[model samples]
Target: MVHFLPDILAFFFIAALIAQRLSVDLRLPDAAYQLITYILLITIGLKGGQAIANNASMALIGHSGLIITMGIVITLVALIIIQIFSKLNKADRVTLAAHYGSVSVGTFAVAVNYLEVSQIPYELTLNLFVALLELPAIILGLYLLSDKTHKLNVKTILAHKSLALIIIGMLIGALYGEISEPLVKNLKPMFGVMLALYLVHMGALAGAKISDIGSNKVFIVSFALIMPLIGASIALFCSWLIGLSHGGATLLAVLGASASYIAVPAVFEQAYPEANIAQALFASLAISFSVNVIWGIELYTQAALLISSL
Candidate 1:
């Protein structure tokens, strides 16, 4: 039973969903969600930084470039698909593409927990990849907006709290390596509990949005179900080309498959006020997130193992 505890934690998401259906008001305060988000971001950043400090080399730099390129490719493909297939307006197509293109820290956290419980050894440096994968999709999304007259505020996007916290944590971890070990050690143990708590909130939020899918329900549902598999396949191929371990490949697949519910939504809400933020969130958070949490993680791991064997 203990071996499956991490998997068991995922059930809280379902429980929260059920509670929401029953009109049980079990929502966490906004502040609590923010706090959990910060801790997870910083912890991931610190660990990745420590890994870099230990394994700093030109190869790592090269790999970082590849990861960034992967993110850009994912974003472009998402945009193209939305353009060709969906009947969503220009602004919404770009917006949804951005959400799909960006990575989700929450989903990444769940993948990390899954790897740990399975005793799968992935590169700790993948944490750095998480930070790397966050922005390119968003920048492209903003640029592709129909209103080109709207100046792109690069400075504001850079200063967004989520990205800033992760970067800050990474720098501290890399620079302070040994000195930061105690802090990392202390925070690491709390990861699982914190993640489970956060998922409950996510479940409730997703549950509330279940009936609020707005228009294009068929298209949105189809895209959410299918995009992750496509993303994961591409990522797995890249992982094999780059010589990643099974665990590393699995996590990379997760990163590729995740959609940015938090960062992308927040940025688009402010920057592209005309975009339908709730619709995008419903697809990313409600549908994509649920698919990844329930089945995608295990499936990706299996695919990674197969690739590694070949």
Candidate 2:
């Protein structure tokens, strides 16, 4: 798996570049993006739900809640630093905060594959954390950006497709458990294939957005690299404190380092129309996504090893 990692990443990245070259005439990347997101989300949700159903225990539920809380804390700490250091407008800062705070499904999925190939076992409930970490950062970022008089619309959030799919998958998992495994047998086997296809679209998206990030290139670039490191640092301490195994700690670090381009962007479109979504999108998809996928996992694993030894 480690040997093939470079090839897999290169294939998608090169494909994305090719797609970008041909994008003037075709909407192939967009079509792929829309189609694969639903597939990935549903598949991820179902897998997590099944794990939860099988392991149903108060401890698991409690751990899940703590994971969500960690996400909120990460968001707050990130926003605070961005607010102090960045010269971007309030809206952009909040947008960046939301993006950094949210989880990246692509990076998370890749980390899972890496773990599987490395023969390291991770908690199945880690699947649920992908979805669990999506919302708090978005809501908190927007809330902080808003004036005291502003009230967020709960209905709008609940209606989001990303959140809805997660809930739907969990409901199915909790009620049906593994009974529906046979039904999804075909789809289950295709998760890796589906992910590779997804990365192609991601690469294309990143290539397209990379050039449009405006004048604050230094700031954006620094934040893209630094924010993930900060998230990884926090998660390292928290995971060890919570007694997560090495694999679990590595995953938490990967997720901590990942920046969301999907769910958070959708949330921002409706919630913070004033914010510059393009910059946030570029930072997450173009820079941070690549950073995490390429070297971020290795960084996390190494960081965990270092921390455990200390």
Candidate 3:
């Protein structure tokens, strides 16, 4: 697991750095980003839909809703901690909160890969949790940051690319039932390639922001490490309370721990234009993502196992 996973992530990361060093003008066009995002959202949605179709149950709905509430609690936890420790203003703190509260698809994919490679069984319906976890924290963070008189425009919220894709994919996947799987089969390989392209671009973007990250390195690094620990603690408790198996506990821990670089940032840049994009990008993409992908998964899994055993 470690051998190929590290190489795949490192290769794109190092490739981006190499591009930066060589002045090779490596950059992804906006079209490519949108296409990749759509593909990923749809893939998860279809998988989730497939899972639900095979085993539609009220209990699953309850579990999804409960896990989503956990997402909100996790968001607020991060926000409160950041407010106390960091000097950033309300907007920046909310921005950071929203990002940290949402799950990272890249990191989620890695965790799923780890479980698969290790032969541990996990809930495939957790993909639905991925869809569920995206919006609440972001909306809650925005509400917290908004003035008392300010009301969120629902239309505007629905129009966001990430939410739209998720909704569309979920609807098609759930409504269409067994038929969607065969149609999507041919498109699977392209998804991996697109993901690699996306990460490559992400690495390049991170490389470009190296100078910006240096100024707040200490604070960002600390938050990245510490926040996941807090999140995992919450997940460990909640998962045990809910009687989740080892794999379910780990995925929940990851959902609590992972941060969004892809979905919310697009909305954030538009919604909170005053917030520091560099800080959000640097913290989520560079710091938190690496921590979760590298060692946090194993750490959270072990912690969850220990907690569950007791």
Candidate 4:
């Protein structure tokens, strides 16, 4: 049930698209919806911090860091492999590269629950690493794009509100850590209620976005679907080298395979406002994230078993 919440959220996303298509008047109150989302974001961060506090250790940090570093490398390697498969320009490649490099916070949250249920132990402080890894790929991808393709100023990219919020969240999470109890407690119920409410609101937003999508973007849609699978394959092979257990390795691969729809697109939209936000969201919603949540876990599990059999 716990491993299912993220999927539920993803469904809410689809519902959003469908609702918009249906022209339903099911709209969330704007102020209330945003307020709920804001609280949920803070709560997720603090909850992650507390999880880390519970499992904090030097060895855990060292191990998780190694896995995380591998995650970054896996994303880059995937980018190279993807370039080999189908030609994408440097800007697109960098955009795609950044997508894979950062862990999907939602996916990471889901995988952690899976581990908890399966009785697998992973370093919870890895949440900090998850937060740490969120932006570098975007930064690196942007620089790669600037040097090789679309030349955008670094300042413009850095100044994005979405990116800024992520940086702030990570910084606050780090500084607060165990010190974050009171605030977290006060925020928890608010987030809990908000998460429930905003899920419905997001459905409406997605519906609106879907209504806006058009037939001219077929090529862009194809790219979004293909990229994450390419990223995940490289991650799976590299996972063994990271010394992750079978379950952990599979989860890590999924993390690497997943794209940051919420985090990346929000930031990228600001920096590359001309770039297709719909493409990113659809790719994540329709292809990558959907694949991961639906049958990807089972698929990875089977592959892990096969590898163990060998």
Of candidates 4 and 1, the better by TM-score = 1
Better of 2 and 4 by TM-score: 2
After best superposition, candidate 4 residue 274: deviation in angstroms?
A: 4.3
Best by lDDT: 1
> Which regions in candidate 2 have their CA more than 4 angstroms from the true location?
1-7, 18-31, 148-150, 183-185, 305-310
RMSD of 3: 2.8
lDDT of 3 by residue, 185-266 (tens): 8666576577677667777776666556645567777897788788778877878877788887898888888888877788
Off by over 4 Å in 4: 1-14, 25-33, 47-68, 81-89, 110-122, 147-226, 233-251, 297-310
Each candidate: RMSD: 1.9, 2.7, 2.8, 4.9
Clashing pairs in 1: none
State every prediction's TM-score relative to the real structure. 0.96, 0.90, 0.87, 0.69
Candidate 2 accuracy as lDDT: 0.79
Model 2: which ten-residue window has the lowest total lDDT?
A: 21-30
The backbone clash count of each candidate, in order, is 0, 0, 0, 3
lDDT tens readout by residue for model 4, 71-113? 5675677577557764555555556567767666555555554
For each candidate in the order shown, give its overall lDDT on alpha carbons. 0.88, 0.79, 0.76, 0.59
Candidate 4 TM-score to native: 0.69
Which number leads on TM-score? Answer: 1
Off by over 4 Å in 3: 1-7, 18-25, 148-150, 214-216, 304-310
